[model samples]
Target: MIQAKAPGKLYIAGEYAVTEPGYKSVLIAVDRFVTATIEDTDTECGSIHSKALHKDQVSFVRKEDKIVISDIDHAKQLKYITQAIEVFEQYVNSKNITLRHFNITIDSDLDDASGQKYGLGSSAAVLVSVLKALNEFYHMQLSNLYIYKLAVIANMKLQSLSSCGDIAVSVYTGWLVYSTFDHEWVKEQIITSTVDEVLIKNWPGLHIEPLQAPEHMKVLIGWTGSPASSHHLVSEVKRLKSDPNIFGHFLKSSQLNVEKLIQAFKTNHIEGVLDSIRKNREVIQYLDAFATVDIETPDLKKLCAIGEKYDGASKTSGAGGGDCGITIVKNDLNRENIYNEWSKNNIKPLRFSIYHGQ
Candidate 1:
């Protein structure tokens, strides 16, 4: 048997802008992970079981043309897994190798006690884990970049639109500055593209660079006690996308701040990071006004205000109607007061960092 695990991701900077090509996002790989285990089986068919997805004994078989999962319920929910297997089959077939039947087990630590997702990229983590496990199990000799691109394809197959920045951070498992692939180009090729065609294409616009948090930096994650629908919020944001003058300004400002944040990390400039985050918060606040959506809720604003009171910077982490927000402080700062204050307001601090492997 072989096992592989991948960490969930958080957006330190660049939330919405990263979706567009040429824009960058700063991402962190959190310790919470999705794990996959694979074991060869004598049966002609293969099977998958996921504890986190509440799926058991889902079966599949390889046909002359393609692999097919038998249970429709499992098939729908297991798109990433099924598509991964298909992609792996294609990869191995090109090498004139027949894949073996196996039983796969999947699990995750990205959920709460009640199984509510924490807006962490659980799907991306699971996809990365499954891809990594298969690559190791079959000795496919695939590069991490190739695995990342394949995972993005699987994710985009289900959701049509993605930056794939999450997949990059999960695969690399650390802090990174990611620029979007030419998703526009990928969308155009989908009508006549194979995995090889897509994979071989040069995405000059895509970039992923690793970085480290400044030694003086400390981050505290807080959950807003509710999960927000990222799809809905992204759709609402898209509506105003047609207004080039307004949205373009938002894009330019957001991109600049994210770049500044990266520069801050590189130079160990504490105030630069805080200032960039503050400017970023303002830009998103303008975005909420333009879209007429509550991207940053009152509770999130309260959290930021508290952080400011403690001489720190705070903002929503993702598409933020509610999921999680983070407070950035000095390493020597007192967290007890901040924790107490957040608890009183019903915000739960999530103890997480870049892939520490708990």
Candidate 2:
């Protein structure tokens, strides 16, 4: 039996800029996690048990050649993990010894976190953990970096677009500066880190004080109830960036901020980290029109109203046509007050940090 776990992340800065390196995005591993456990046996077939979601009942799992969920409108949308499974089968087939008889279990706390409901790269965590476990289960000799790449390929299968940042940080286990545009540099920095120290070092999450919501902080998250189409949104943005002038400046600003954050992280300066976060927020807002759109809902409007009283800023979390709204309250005596106010209004505040994928 093999068991593995991966943590979820909260993007502290550059939420939208991640799709295109406009704002250097950072992810941190949070307390919440998504895990996979596998029990190998001599049985004839492989089966999957999804303990988190109880909606599906199947006698068997879908084959790679079968209807991949990535193709269907939505079938768990776990194509990243499924795709990795496909590649693993190919490798296993060449070896001939069947390890098919297995009971796979997956569990997650990626949804409605702290009552904040929306997807935030939960699939990325699942892909990372499963790839590592499967690699070990099959006795495939692959380095952590190599296995991480396999998960990134799985992500590509999902949307044909993937940034190695999410999964890389998940497997790397530390505070890191990652960029998909510069995969070589990202890998270099991550590989250079002593993983043993990062995992065992006692850390203070107390530095995660709430930021003041700038008055300009006009934010909202409109839930379509039906999931928004990330593929369509990604494609539209790609087309817009065809104008070199617009994207050139965008990329340049992002790359610069990334360097500043890297220096701050190296020095272990909390104030510097927060300063960089504030600056990057502006970079993300101006990167593109899709960064913040008209899909923000009325409930989101109410939350903003509450945060306004606290004197801070807010924005949507992901691809942002509509999903979860993230509110940052600047230093104030009323930070907790504002958080409590939102809760009274049925909004469960999420304590998110950039250090979440460890």
Candidate 3:
């Protein structure tokens, strides 16, 4: 059996901006991971088990020379798995290599005890994990960029629009500055083009660069006890972006803050980073009010206020509404107080580190 793990991710800055080409976002892969185990089997059909999805076993059989889901319920829940199988199978087949039947197991530590997702990019992590396992199992010799591209394609096939910054962070761990491919261009290619053609296509605006975090800083993640659907929030943000009046202001402010934060990271300036975070939070607040979108929920606002009381800066991490908020704490600050404050508000403080694995 071959096993692979991919870490879940959080966006530190550039939430809505990354959806557009030429804008940069800072993403960090957290400690939580989705693990996929693949093993060759002799049953002529493949089976899958997912601890996170609560499926004991689901079968996939070769039909019409294509691997497809044979279980109804698993088909709905394990779209990420089946799509990955289809994509990888197609790629390997093109090389004149016949894929063998395999049993795959997926497990994730990214969810809460009650199975609520923490908006840690579980779907992207799952895709990355499964693709990485297949890459290793088949000895595909896929480069890091190729692995990232495959995951993004699979995500686009499953979900209509995706920045894929999460996929990149999972493939290349640690802190990163990420800019997305043009969403419209990617979507158009996926709709009108074949996978092979798209694979070799030049993605003009996409960029991913590794970044180092400051040594004297600490990050705290607090889950708001409610999972926000990134799909829903992103859709609303897209609609809001059409209004030049609202989105135009948001884009400029967000880009400025992100640029400042990155510069601070380069110089190891803690205060500069914290200052930009505060300004970024203000930008989000203004956007929420101007657009009447719930980018920052009441709980998230409360979370930020708590962090402010302790001389730390905090903001909702991604496509807001709920899920987790990130707080930037200096090393000298008392983290216990921040943790307790979040606990009192029914928020769970997650113990996480930047991903250290490739």
Cα-based TM-score, every candidate:
0.96, 0.69, 0.96
**Candidate 2 Cα outliers beyond 4 Å, as residue runs:** 20-23, 55-78, 92-98, 113-117, 139-141, 181-229, 288-316, 325-335, 344-346, 351-358
What C-alpha lDDT does candidate 2 achieve relative to the native structure? 0.55
Clash pairs (backbone) in predicted model 3:
none
Candidate 2 similarity to native, TM-score:
0.69
Please give the RMSD to the true structure for each candidate, in Å. 1.7, 8.7, 1.5
Per-residue lDDT of model 1, residues 281-330, tens digit only: 88888888877679999888888878778888889988999888988888
Q: For model 1, what is the error of residue 331's alpha carbon versus the real structure, in angstroms, after optimal superposition?
A: 1.0
Report clashes for each candidate as comma-separated counts.
Answer: 0, 19, 0
In candidate 1, which residue pairs get closer than 3 Å at backbone N, Cα or C atoms, i.e. clash? none
Candidate 2, 1-358: lDDT as tens digits: 8887877654545544465532455554555567889877564556665666643422234464342332243355445556767655554554665646566677787676343335556778788778777877878766665666566545655554555566766776544445554433433433453322222232221011223222322222223233445555556656657777766666677667656755665665545554665566556556544433333355555665676566555544445454555555434455677678877877666554433232
Ten-residue stretch with the least lDDT total in model 3? 64-73
lDDT of prediction 3: 0.87
